[model samples]
Target: MAYAIRPFRKHDAAALADLTLAAIRSLGAERYSDEQVAAWASRHGTADRFVVRAATGDAIFVASDADDRPVAYALVGMRGKEVGHVDMLYCHPDHARKGLADELLAQVEHHCRAHKVTRLFTEASELARGPFERAGYTVTHRRDFAIPHEGREVAIHNYAMEKPLT
Candidate 1:
């Protein structure tokens, strides 16, 4: 099936939140407990924040859909000094392994190139590392953080990955 990719709209926030939460929850039974997932989802799933971020020209939110409903989305931000950051990249669990993330990354890279960005960076979870690596990102560091969920802290380890854009 063909996917439609475009800039995020204010009305798309609710859909984006759902997609984000779904991606997080799909990490599996052991990666994160239900309590942790629920907590993180509560904060990150806010449609208002997505709208505000999209309104900021510095950030770009792109969504890919089949049949006019979003199945994947990515948020990219241009940092200072020719640097770009992938704030988030999520695909519905059902859509995983179907090249949607790759397409979204390609779009972000194209945006970076058009704007003269020299480097792109992302903090990728273990589950996401392989795809980023295949797309040419190299891990520069590994860090552990406590992600707050349901009034408790859930430890999550992720890699700081970077790739040259130019």
Candidate 2:
């Protein structure tokens, strides 16, 4: 199936929220334990979250189906207008392995470059590590952390990766 990459729209917020949860519950289950998955997913809010992020200056890109519905999306943030951060990237399970995430990331890199961003970094989930690495990001370290879930701490680990755009 063919997909198009474009800047985010307000209506896409709900779809992005749904896609985010599905990606976390589906693909995220492959490498993460039940507790970890729950904790990770708990961090995601509703469509308002996406709207707020976009409103706050984060650049969001969406990969849409031919019908104009979002299938994958990526969120990027710029700090001091020079450092870029890949804050979130997710694809619906049905759309996985179709190069959507890759294209979205490429769009992000291009967007970052256009804004004079020189370095890109992210805390990449285990499932996302391979894709980020393939995009030329090197793992800086394995970041182990914990999140509060249902009154207890759930442990999780992801790679801290970075790519030099210069």
Q: In lDDT terms, which candidate is top? A: 2
TM-score, candidate 2, is 0.96
Q: Write the per-residue lDDT of candidate 1 for residues 1-166, one digit (tens) a residue.
A: 7788787877788888887888887753336667656655665777787787666655554556566777888787765542588878888887878887787888888888998888899998777788888889999999788777656787767799999976
After TM-score superposition, what is the CA distance of residue 115 in candidate 2 from its true location, in Å?
Answer: 0.7
Candidate 2 lDDT, 46-140, residue by residue in tens: 99988887888899999999999999999998655424989999999999988887888899999999988889999999989988988999999
Q: State each candidate's clash count.
A: 0, 0
lDDT of 1 at 165: 73
**RMSD for each model, in Å, please?**
2.3, 1.3
Lowest lDDT sum, 10 consecutive residues, model 2, at 77-86
Reference-based lDDT, residue 110, model 2: 94
RMSD of 1: 2.3
Q: In model 1, which residue pairs have backbone atoms overlapping below 3 Å?
A: none
